[model samples]
Target: MTITIERTRTAPQPTRQQPAADPKPATGSFQTVQPDLEVTAPLGERYDEILTPEALAFLARLHDRFAHTRHELLAVRLQTRVDAANGRDPKFLPETEWIRNDTTWRVAGAGPGLEDRRVEITGPTDRKMAINALNSGAKVWLADHEDATSPTWANVVEGQLSLFDFLRGNLEYTSPEGKEYRVTASETPTIVFRPRGWHLVEKHLKFHDRAGRAMHASGSLVDFGLYFFHNAKALIEGGRGPYFYLPKLESHREAKLWNDIFTFAEEELGIPHGTIRATVLIETIQAAFQMDEILYELRDHCAGLNAGRWDYIFSIVKTFRSRGRRWVMPDRKQITMTVPFMRAYTELLVQTCHKRGAHAIGGMSAFIPNRRDPEVTERALAAVSADKRREAGDGFDGTWVAHPDLIPTARAEFDAVLGERPNQVDRLRDDVQVTAAQLLDIPSGSGEVTEAGVYDNVSICIRYIESWLRGTGAAAIDNLMEDAATAEISRSQVWQWLHDNTVTAEGTRIDQTSIVRIMAAAVADLPRFEGDRFDDAISVFRSVALEPEFPTFLTVGAYARFL
Candidate 1:
């Protein structure tokens, strides 16, 4: 499990100031902008380790250099949507055809701990959960700072603290019930940090431009900067460098932005070039078409691609919600990975990744087993097994599960195919010949809208949003690990249904008015909670879900409400 520098690429280094000429901070990186860093959020005791002056300076440097580009890329995202609305939808980029056609290039293959990721469990980075996940018997723990995490100041700071302890083999926790949880050497998973996506802003931290205008730093940069600044050397010493799961990238340009950030950070920290590895989440429809170029842009640092199913569905609905009924999707349950579009998406992912000698990781099975109910647990396991069997059989190197209880089942499925193998990267999936039409084919009769579906959507979203407001992002509801992505899917599907003015199977017509009623009733039925975030959550949900214009992500607006 040593850090793998064997396949590390040697490229022309970026020009930087000599250590003697630069002001040496505690992190040993030169400070570019020394503007006063402000933390507006509540600072808990012991957060100093994560938000040290040197770390804040590192974050400020990253923001000063790349925050403008992040803004520009967001604008580009809006413009892409506008162009799609005007009949210039995203397609295979002719300009980047050379990158896709050239088969000679391959990404830096799997790094040390990531070489075998047959089953990666994902969860928020609370101390207890962090300890449990690292010992969950999964190959990798997606230490999530994104959808599975609510951006409360305490959670953010404490999560960083947990990761700091994890790398040093000192992660420990004792529950209120006196249950002790600690990392074990016998079953430790590789840690892959999933920062917030590019769309989010860290309101707690503020930076000023040269013009003296204050602005919030990009959440992605903050999470990435703080983690790399604090733990790059520690993780490397632990036989792994900083690894990331980049989510919701829409194009190769975004991926290139990430690559540039990686390069800059590596040089700034004096780490080896290509010491960082990333797995891009192909969660957006636009990114699906640009997988080849994304990998190409980060080839020197890319590890693979992931099939992020729920958010991918949310993207499809959000991107094409105004296109009339032709692209209107059915119930979420019916649009499982076996559907035409999803199958094409997964097949294309495996084909593209294996073609370029990268690992092709499958989507998440978010079912948290019901330990008290044997029948429910068995059924969940059966479904998860089938999903992994399909993925492993179809040439995927690994798959994801949200709960540790299902890890043995998922691992067994992959073990059937990857016996004595770290990964199936050599399984090139030459048989997957997918075309644009095949990938975009909206399946007919996927599922009918029903009264049950409508109510469930409202209920699940309200439930999730309430927990999110209370500082928990991953909520166990109905035996499923529901995160912001699931809430997105729930709300977006309802919006799509309302947009299409579709009638349910049981003759219930879904309208904005009806949805509002359902939302009200859903909230009213819930037991009294301690806070008013339920009201705020419902307000945000209604605006994003029922409005004429769809917001990019529910968390963006909802985050501002609480965090």
Candidate 2:
């Protein structure tokens, strides 16, 4: 069952970014200031409210001040990958060991409305979802603009508008059928926004520094700046600050970068320092080894750490893909949280966070409830409950749920462990000891690449990629909340299987041709309703999964080429 495909790979090249000798950027808010910043995308309805001249200028300032550091960190990420390929694997920084051992230093701990995060509902910030999430009886609402929502220009601006309305008590939605949605919860979940990662660029916005240079803006700064500038003061006045969830960070240096941005933003906005609290997602393997240092770097403005499971798996695959069979993973389904390596990662996260008086949040369980089928919903809830229970028993203070209905089940598990306490941050798992080798121990997991797993990977890659292309980043496929992180795992698994020449449990050789056939069948199974972009999705899956060289992220190349 070998496919007649080119099995050769061109080695990955080093990606280095050097600062321009002079950078020019400005956004004229009035007649006095020249409009040095340009908007490349068309203005959508209500965009003016979010993209006011003053906000644009503030965003421009942030870009100019921090863009170079973002680029340097990104380059370091690539070099780290290249170094791993050459046998220099990621390890704890010797220079930062002092920070790791300094037991007296502690993070700012939890901010207002963030003390108890037992059940956090994660979704996009569209008017409807925002209301529903607010009404949902969860402790926090992760108003996600990152992987959960596609970064279409309209979405970016409108998302800000939604958040603005939410903060001002002005959010109201009426469906075409005249049904109304409102934030009815007496105590709505606290909002913690998740911006796009540093690797991404907001191409629609162009910045010209005072030094007269033009370049695309960093998506991180753009999202953070607009939201922080417009909402920070309001949030502070409302007794909540501009809290955030920092994603895809690879090193402690990147944590320092975020800490600097937080300082600058607070000073610029006239808000007090340490007002902005951030929860860093320990998704990358490199970051797992530097948890203590990451918390130390942002101690003044840090909340806690989250175990982003899917992206963590994808990161492992991306960082160690060129290392051959020892690094190859089996079916994505087989990499459960209880697996030894995953156990090590999560246990270590809980241990590190509790040791520093920070919350240890658990990862997302893709098993979402099904509304149409009572039987399916029952099974899904059971699965989600079990996963949440494990996290709670293992010392996690909170967990993530994609759908609102699953909130109770997750809450119950946490309540069972948490009792009347606000959180279990005091439960420091001192007994948990994890080594780098344990964290990197992929072979210990029990699983294999079955033929069914290969086809499942192909089908998910095609379906999820199509959903993303159609401007819905979070898609419910096969009864799970599929997002960019899960899609990365799906596609990268195929690439990994092909790269390692893995054989299914039934002894079939997995290859590109077989995957192509499986993808076609998957597409055939999906109803090609009007406006659906199946063809485009297939092409994206092919490009990302079948390429000779592995893409660091599935979204980066796709976003750069299209949208």
Every model's TM-score: 0.93, 0.93
Alpha-carbon local distance difference test for all models:
0.85, 0.85
Candidate 1 off by > 4 Å: 1-36
How many residue pairs in model 1 have overlapping backbones?
Answer: 0
Residue-level lDDT tens digits of model 1 in 345-397: 99999999998988899999999888799999999899999999999999999
Alpha-carbon RMSD of each model: 6.6, 8.6
**Candidate 2 Cα errors over 4 Å, as ranges:** 1-36
Model 2: lDDT of residue 270: 79
lDDT of 2 by residue, 68-115 (tens): 888898999888888998988788788988988888988999999899
**What lDDT is obtained when candidate 2 is compared to the true structure?**
0.85
Give the distance in Å from residue 546's predicted Cα in candidate 2 to where it truly belongs: 0.4
Model 2 residue 414 distance off true place after TM-score fit, in angstroms: 0.8
